[model samples]
Target: MKIWNEPYLETCCRAALHRLVLVGGGGRPDGLKDGPCLERLQGMGLARLRADGRYELTEAGRERHAGEILKLRKAG
Candidate 1:
């Protein structure tokens, strides 16, 4: 029942999901924006906090979000 898993991810906030999409797209968050979702993503190795205080998505994160996008498209 990991938060990054599809089931949990489906229930996560759109804002958090949007952040993941941004990170996956090579956009970095500029500050410490720690919260339950971000922390869980970090713990799951999906997102990471860089030494420069920016957040970037890991490769797995990109893949996951890609899959999510596909699912969203199909669901619509």
Candidate 2:
């Protein structure tokens, strides 16, 4: 995770980054979102959410991380 350029996205509640990113896009941070970034990252096999309030990085996630993050992809 340190190797990636992932900006520390501020989440309303601890959860998968997909939900946070989507919700942080000026939308209310509810339990779910109309469009979650999780699905895209999921497609990339880079991120996931557990039953707990945590979004974790997978093996592929480390590889996608270029460590050039200037800002959160979507920050509210």
Candidate 3:
């Protein structure tokens, strides 16, 4: 089995992930300023683009958010 090492994310990308979570994880773009951040997140397997063309957090992204952004500990 492969171990999961958390990828390093920039401040902007973290903010973008938080925003994605706040917005219910899909639908509607609040402008296009986050393209680069989204791309980075997508490349890291943290976020994914939906069929409707909106970006949302994957399971890893949500876990990252809970740990990094929200400062919550993950339960084993």
Candidate 4:
């Protein structure tokens, strides 16, 4: 697993937030499916690339997503 740092956490957290918003709106954009952004999350084991080229949240990702939401709620 990749080391968790402030920058990486921020990136992943923001990505998680974006994913949440997109999921709520409908779905992810095509560009994000196989993009480097998702790839980074994939490498971190927070996301999985499906055979259809879509990203699905791993269990870790679900936790991260919930954690990110908590952080944001606290920040606000």
Which candidate leads in lDDT?
3
The C-alpha stretches of model 2 lying farther than 4 A from their native spots are 1-35, 67-76
lDDT of 4 by residue, 1-76 (tens): 8666633555644665457445742434446533666667677887776766566667777777777666777899
RMSD of each: 4.7, 9.8, 4.7, 5.1
- Each prediction's total of clashing residue pairs, residues at least 3 apart in sequence or on different chains, is 0, 2, 0, 0
Q: Please give the range of 10 consecutive residues that has the lowest summed lDDT in model 3.
A: 23-32
Q: Rank all candidate structures by their lDDT, best first, as comma-separated numbers.
A: 3, 1, 4, 2
lDDT of every model, 2 decimals? 0.63, 0.44, 0.79, 0.62
The residue-by-residue lDDT of candidate 3 on 1-76, one tens digit each, is 9776888778888889888888874542634798899888888888888877888888988888988888723443
TM-score of 4: 0.61
Error of 3 at 62 (Å): 0.4
**What lDDT, from 0 to 1, does candidate 1 have?**
0.63
Comparison by lDDT, 2 against 4, better one: 4
Q: What's the CA error at residue 31 for candidate 1, in Å?
A: 5.7
Candidate 1 weakest ten by summed lDDT: 5-14
Colliding pairs, model 2:
5-67, 18-38
Q: lDDT by residue for model 2 over 7-71, one digit each (tens)?
A: 44334222454333444324233245522555455555666655564445555554444221213
